[model samples]
Target: MKTLNSYLSETVINMKPSGIRKFFDLAANMEGVISLGVGEPDFVTPWNVREACILSLEQGFTSYTANAGLYELREKISEYLFKRFDLQYDPAEEIIVTVGASQAIDIAFRSIINSGDEVLIIEPCFVSYAPLVTLAGGKPVSVSTFGEEEFKVNPEILEKYITSKTKAIMICTPNNPTGTVLSKKELEAVAQIAKRYDLLVVADEIYAELCYEDEYVSMPSIEGMKERTILISGFSKGFAMTGWRLGYIAADRVFARAMLKVHQYSIMCAPTMAQYAALEALENDEDVLYMRKSYQRRRNYIVQSLNEAGLFCHMPGGAFYAFPSIKSTGLSSEEFAERLLLEEKVAVVPGNVFGQSGEGYIRCSYASSMEQLQEAMKRIKRFVQSL
Candidate 1:
């Protein structure tokens, strides 16, 4: 008899496990490990949001919703987008709530990507983008941004990666790992390129609410980009509702319909109770703002501490992460991360897992409590000094 692994799809069999989760698993088994590995918020979901879900359950509103998700939740998402980012979409026709932004991303690629088509992905991006593209039977082409550029995507360099096979460009901001938020001008430039190439733009703005610098620029708000841009976001990061697993996609009707078809077959609809919880989250911006402020403070302290310890970290403009260069310690990214965890009981993700361009750094999420962050920093400082 052949091995069970032989029966697995070649695509699934060959895919590498997530690099972020490796450290997370390592830290999980070890006691006294101050882990900054995962990007989840240390904050709990706000009381009112949880209360709304509990209320829904008590009311016995636990049946399946529309395949496109609750219309009211879609409307609230539409309103929130317009109110916060000046982006507009039709609640009934242009949005589909899915099981977190991860699902939104999956369906978006599956709907548009044909076998052998290419999607231009900016690195160091979330690990899922490339794999999802591959699973969709599309090639994920890397358009790497450097630290010297503050990890901001450059349109000229982006255009260099385009070819007849190229079908779409996927971008995230405020970005994961790097925390670099693109300016409106930068987005406009990429918009022009997308329009010129007649390519789709899958904009992952999951961390939009956490932006700390100049105004957050929604890609769909860019002129002529809305029709081509598929906006993926959720309550996971900014709303402190990671476990709620509620996210939505906003796109033109043509794209929305196609993606809805894929989502209906795969997920049916997002969780019914989570929709109620997300509705409450949308109504309560104050809680999200409070969390953002706390993350910003943590960001400031972590960046400062990393620089002081001679790790040469850039001050991230958004998100709750610090990508500090570990090159000075004369260790590879994985070596640095493993040694830091083993020797100092501090856990962080190595940058090389994100992409080749990330080889010299490590990503430290500052979403933990201030006390935890302070202690982690002290341990990190001592480790670096010893190096």
Candidate 2:
């Protein structure tokens, strides 16, 4: 009989579990532990979107959709993309509904990467990017961005990483861990470099609508990037629809067709009820604005609170996370996080888990209520003083 390790493929054996979820699991067994570790939004899915799903279920709409998804849902996603970002996706051929933005990300990598292709990844970035690129038979090369630059990738530095083997670059704006949003000027530079290199771009814009100080720009909207960009987004963050697991990919026909082939075998289709709910979500921008405003206030509160408590954090222009430096605490990020959770009963993710550049920092999600934030701040302050 073969052992379990013997049966596992090298790729599956090599992948590390997500660091964010690890702390969350530890915090769960403890009572009254206030957590800021997970990236999920705190808000409930809007009532109208939930109602649409319930209605669809009541009407017995329970079957697999066309491999691409419901034509109407795709049509609405196309219209929404055009109106919001000036993107034109041909709903029928250019859009494919996905399980969540996560799956869309995975298949996007798989569709484009040939074995040993190098994918330039901007760090410190989302944890999944490297693992996903590895799974796609590609190597992930880190391109570091600094805190002084507000975590935006500099184009001049980006030029140094390119080689003939580099096939694509993955970008996330309104980024996780650090909440930086790329400006139009930054994107223009990136677009020019990508155009010069003839590389594909996977722009993860899941937090596009959550921008606070500046309006978010879609990468595909930049000149010369339309045909070569694979855009991934979802109803998770902006719509508070995490459990719905509905997302989409918008690419030109060639890439979309290839990705759909993977989706057909791996997922078949997104849930039928979730599609109706997402259709309803597209009709209600008011709900999104409401959540964004609330989050912005919480962002203001947490950033200020963390700084006042002796942690230095830059002003994150978007997303609900506050990436604060813990250097003064004289502890490694893992030591800081583990001690804080055990001592203060406040949970957060260590920054180094995001990438090597993330050492000496921690990511605190302010998506929780003001009450939880208040308590979490107090506990963290006491913990720091004790050390």
Provide TM-scores for the models: 0.99, 0.98
Deviation (Å) of 108 in candidate 1: 0.3
Per-residue alpha-carbon lDDT of candidate 2 for residues 213-294, written as tens digits (9 for 90 to 100): 8767999999889898999999999999999998999999999999999999999999999999999999876889989999
Q: Write the per-residue lDDT of candidate 1 for residues 12-64, one digit (tens) a residue.
A: 98999999888999999999999898889999999999999999999999999
Best-performing candidate as measured by lDDT: 1
lDDT of all the models against the reference?
0.94, 0.92
**What TM-score does model 2 achieve against the real structure?**
0.98
Q: Candidate 2: which stretches are off by over 4 Å?
A: none
Q: Total clashes, candidate 2?
A: 0
Worst 10 residues of 1 by lDDT: 284-293
Clashing pairs in 2: none
